[model samples]
Target: MSDARRPNPSNEIMRRKWVRQLRDALLLPPALLYVIIEEIFWNGATALLRQIARTWPVRALQKQLMALPAPVILPLFLVPEILSHIGGFWAAYLVTRGEWAAAMVAGIVIKGSATLMVVWIYQSCERKLLSIRWFAVVHRQALRGRDWVLEKIRPGKELALRLLRRSRAGIIRRFAAIRQVLAARLGFRRRS
Candidate 1:
């Protein structure tokens, strides 16, 4: 190759760095979203559902759901997931149309409902659904992806938690001040 045609090490290094930067920038939004969805919505909703599921009526319903066959259980497991995608698409469309408040409300309601249903059904019918080989494979892959994302975002998560912990007292004081101001404006004086 001629001198001009030869690859340059410095240029290659710079290009790689630029590519890395671009890749990280692109990945950050989705990674943060996954973290938020998993940590906030999924965990909280699932925990609440789990408590509800422990009630006698819910337990009876779950027992009936678990008795369902594998084929039936598959669709039951999938419908909520499909609804989730549709809801997400609708929410994105709302955002594109500049309906910010509506989009936020719709996204939360749709996503939260779908998440609760999916978690509830999955927890109830786990064994039956897992009996299907294809589902088991997909479930395993989904779990692996979750683990990978969590691992990738671990540093950011730690940093956020650390900052929140450090700011906890300040945040409480600010909230207290805001409450006092609001209460005074509303003519609700403190008895003490």
Candidate 2:
């Protein structure tokens, strides 16, 4: 290739950097929202558990639950978590069917129910749950499956990045124009 037609290595690096930054900026809002929702759920669940634990009947039940073997108590602990996951999948199905209100209600109900179940499990049989061999095996297998799926999807992610890079300049210009229009409408003077 002629020197004039050659791609500059530094420019390639800069383009990659810009794309990564843009991707991060675009993703930040949703990631932050997820973190906020998770925090709210965790705190709310903990508070509810504390309130529940103060009841004499629940404390007595917890004492009885604590005496059970891991094999017996593990099923009780796992059942609620499995049901919550099923409810979430059902909500997703409802969303696909365009039942937005029903999906929202299902999501809320599942979360609330799951929170209570988890709190009860923790309060009642935390040690027994941890001691279950089959539970640990299942958890590890699920993690492995998640990692495998993510690995499989990585090539598609790279193809998307490549397409985005090819169109980067046009997208940047469109966004710049939008910024200028908004600045003008808001009576802000553009710096040269």
Candidate 3:
């Protein structure tokens, strides 16, 4: 076999061992932390909201509000998301005060309140909020702006992807060249 095509068992084993160590030492802990955070904050909040929505009074109010016109009810749908964002910032502020436990409690409470508000608005209005004239105008303008921005950035994104691919290929080629030079040096030394 040509030297380029020959498989080096030692290199393969070393590479596998290095990858295993990297994964165990560097990758696993961060991945586990991310999953835990997602489950606790996102999934837990969703479950809480679902449970609250099942109550009788909230359900009745939702039904009543849902029967109303879209323009009249549209403003209510915006409250929860805005409040939740504000609450998140507030929780972060609390954390800076060294009140980690209180920060967590505040975050949960704020999220729960926001989720409840959202659920109530959503159950009552559905997609009717989009039908409001002023809201529709703003939504359309926002979409147009987004499209314009994307169009402008599309060339830059493609350039970045192209550069990244080229850089990766160049690095691989350089590594192969270095490996060949090292192997040649080692083989000459062994023969001598």
Candidate 4:
């Protein structure tokens, strides 16, 4: 048989090993990611609100945060992030083929990864706001300081965010309302 037609055992083994590695590299623990992402999003959001809080200087961040409910919270943690992993596998496949296809695949992977990264950051804010839990401390702490801390948190925003955590339904309703307002304000030319 021609060499091109012959199967190579070493190549097969290597591909298996690579595939395993890719699966393992999906993402790190949510809690750990939550901590790092939280700090960054909080600080950044604080700065953004400070710039735009002319209406309510003292607690603009708090208020804005509160107005945001959990349903909105769901997509922030979901879509882009989960798609990112899906994108990763697509990326791996891209590497073995056309250069443009690889680039497109890589873009998808990056977008997904970036979204997950944003989720990580938002999660940090969410943890501090809604108080996300860590698996490691499951035996000891259960969503600790979440409600208490938020109740005491500033800007009158906590009430809304607090309420979001209270009822998933409310969150969905509010998120729909907010999204509609946002779409109107932004004047969307296209829908995502």
TM-score of each: 0.72, 0.50, 0.44, 0.30
Clashes per candidate, residues 3 or more apart or on different chains:
0, 0, 1, 8
Query: Measured by TM-score, how close is model 1 to the native structure?
Result: 0.72
* lDDT, each prediction: 0.81, 0.72, 0.68, 0.53
Off by over 4 Å in 1: 1-25, 169-192
Instruction: State the TM-score for model 2.
Output: 0.50
Better of 3 and 4 by lDDT: 3
Best by lDDT: 1
Cα error of candidate 1 at position 75, Å: 0.5
Candidate 3 local lDDT, 26-144, one digit each (tens): 75454444333434555555544565566788688778888888866866767776776677777778989999998888777885577567655754565787667787787688566
Q: Can you rank all candidates by TM-score, best first?
A: 1, 2, 3, 4
Model 2 pairs whose backbones collide = none
lDDT tens digits, residue span 80-166, model 2: 777766766777689899999999887779865885786687567766776777777776785665454445546875898899999
Residue by residue across 1-192, what tens digits does model 1's lDDT show?
A: 899999999999999999988987798677667656656767867866865775699889888888889899888879888877677677778989999888888778887788788889887778888989999999899787677678778998899989998989999899889878866875554567
